[model samples]
Target: MAVGRPRTFDCDVALDHAMEVFWRHGYEGATIAQLTEAMGINPPSLYAAFGSKEGLLKAALDRYTERRAAWMEEVLSAPTAREVAERMLMGVAEKQTNPANPPGCLLVQGGIACGTGSASVPFELAARRAQTEEQLRDRFARAKEEGDLKPSADPAALARYVSAVSVGMGVMASSGADREALAQVAAVAIKAIEEQSAR
Candidate 1:
């Protein structure tokens, strides 16, 4: 129950535009007309290609996580839990301030100004964030099993702490915090992990 595909527009290119639009405006604020306008596609074409506004948002969010959060996956490869934490913290400090990309993070920004109309939007955004935090928790749990972290260390708490700091960093970045400030914040976060992991 949709329309024909356009010969002139590329899905990937339009998705990139939609990602920026969604990044600038939170999930609830992004309108279908705005999305189609940014994608240079009509309503039926958009529906045919993406199913609905929410579907298009899901696509844009996937693209954003793949492209922007690649560093998170990379950090998970570090040899130690401390290394993983530090690398992830530092990476956020660097990327959140990149002039080339939109400030803050798509994962965190999506729910910042979330409203009641599209209840699923906040749930989707929160789920993505929770998924990342769960990764951190798993990483820390493994570290504990491997004796890198203390046997008594609560992986969930450590993961939540790091996640909270990361979210704060995103908020600060969106509020115009510079790279140096974010770096200082990252240092503080990494230092806390270092102090605890040393135990």
Candidate 2:
């Protein structure tokens, strides 16, 4: 029997690798050659699996959304909203400061690049932002219901604030902000929440 080539294609792994490349360099900045090289596959193989770079990015965005939602679920379900908020901020802080991973959020970096270059990507990014904001608002609403947040505070507003901070942190991380600085910024948010929740 003739020996066949070892199986090297794993769609999941390839998509993840592609995602990271797009995450680091954004869509327009990432060339097909770069993606293929990073994915360890030929152009034909990548195109066959992912259709095109845009298709691959959309799929990757879906994966990221699902993964982030799962993580948010865990954070939101904490015993107290204070714990939830702190943990959420801590997670962001760690991600920002972690040298092993990409410096900033893939969506935010891509959105910035895309908004200036293409019309469609901005809408795509907006939809993603809306989804994320909804998820965050749900968590904040739960916290409010549990009396972990001030009765007078608006869950939507708080969620928006948290989201804003997260985006800022992503930018700061890309700009080489230190862990201590991230933690300090996170602490400010946490403190504000604590004060309100205490009311």
Candidate 3:
């Protein structure tokens, strides 16, 4: 059998566009027309490629998590676990409040206002959010074993604290909080980590 030709539309490019739509408008609020228009594909083509609006959103979410989450890896690469968290908080503050992109996080904005039919959307987002915190926890746990973190520190609790601050910053950014305000929020969260620092 002969190999078929590749898709004319670039799935990654289209998905990036779709992500912006859902990022700006919550899953419940983003209309199919808006999505199709933003993706530069007709309704039939959109359905054929993505199955449905939910499917398209799923693909978009996957792209967002995979690509955007790369930043976390960099933040996690700091010399110490405390630096990892501080970098994560400050980076989030910077990115969330960036004027070039939509304010707030795609992981957060996509899940808010999700109807009962869209319940899985929020759960999916929650899982992704939890996954990042889990990563942080593992890093902190290693730090404790390596003597970078105080033995008395609770890795899980610290992870939860950072996750909470990150989520709060997203919500505040969505509500029009300025970069300086978010920076202050990040600073407050980092202070707790600083107090826990071995140095």
Candidate 4:
């Protein structure tokens, strides 16, 4: 029996293109035509490789998370809780405003809005965001235990605040905020974290 033909396109390259399309346009906003065009593959190939649009998104998100792992590790390993916040906020400002990639984060822009058919998209993105928040919270808790943060400081609250600020910065970047503006926002956030440490 004759075997099927080989896939001509590189899966990694295709996924990267698909991810950028998804990042620029939310779940409901991205059309199959757009994804296929960006991936340089036909609809059948997409279905055969990834199963469905949602499946492709899951794969893309996994790729995105993998790319972020190193940065997250470095941020969490900061010598103090304040440094962690500083690194996180400042890093987000720079990343979101980088000219090389799309404005706004994939995690933030990928699922901010979805129709009933794609309702699970938001929850998927939320879970990922919550995971990041949990990591920061655990790091802050460790900092408090080590006396790097004041005894009165709330690790969970600080983590949530930082996460909220990061999310806000992504939104601002998507809305055309420049690096300088985001840097100023990050500066204010770092000052707040520093004040908490002094309390």
Q: Top lDDT: which candidate number?
A: 4
Clashes in each model (backbone N, CA, C under 3 Å)? Answer: 0, 0, 0, 0
The digit string of per-residue lDDT tens for model 1 on 1-199 reads: 8986445789889999998878777787778888889999889888888888889889988887777467777888787888988898888889889998789988877766766667788788778888889989999888888888877689899889988999899999988999899989888888877766745
Whole-model lDDT, model 2: 0.79
The models' CA-based lDDT, in order, is 0.84, 0.79, 0.89, 0.93
Candidate 3, overall lDDT? 0.89
- Where is model 1 poorest over a 10-residue stretch in terms of lDDT? 110-119
Off by over 4 Å in 1: 1-8
Residue-level lDDT tens digits of model 4 in 123-188: 999999999999999999998998888999999999999999999999999999999999999999
The C-alpha stretches of model 2 lying farther than 4 A from their native spots are 1-8, 115-117
**How does model 1 fare in lDDT?**
0.84
Best by TM-score: 4
Q: By the lDDT metric, which is better: model 1 or model 4?
A: 4
Tens digit of per-residue lDDT, candidate 2, span 95-147: 76788778877777666665454557757766887777777788878878877
In candidate 3, what are the lDDT values of residues 14-129, reduced to their tens digit? Answer: 99999999999989999999998898888888898989888998899889888867798898778897788889989989999888878999889989998888889998889989
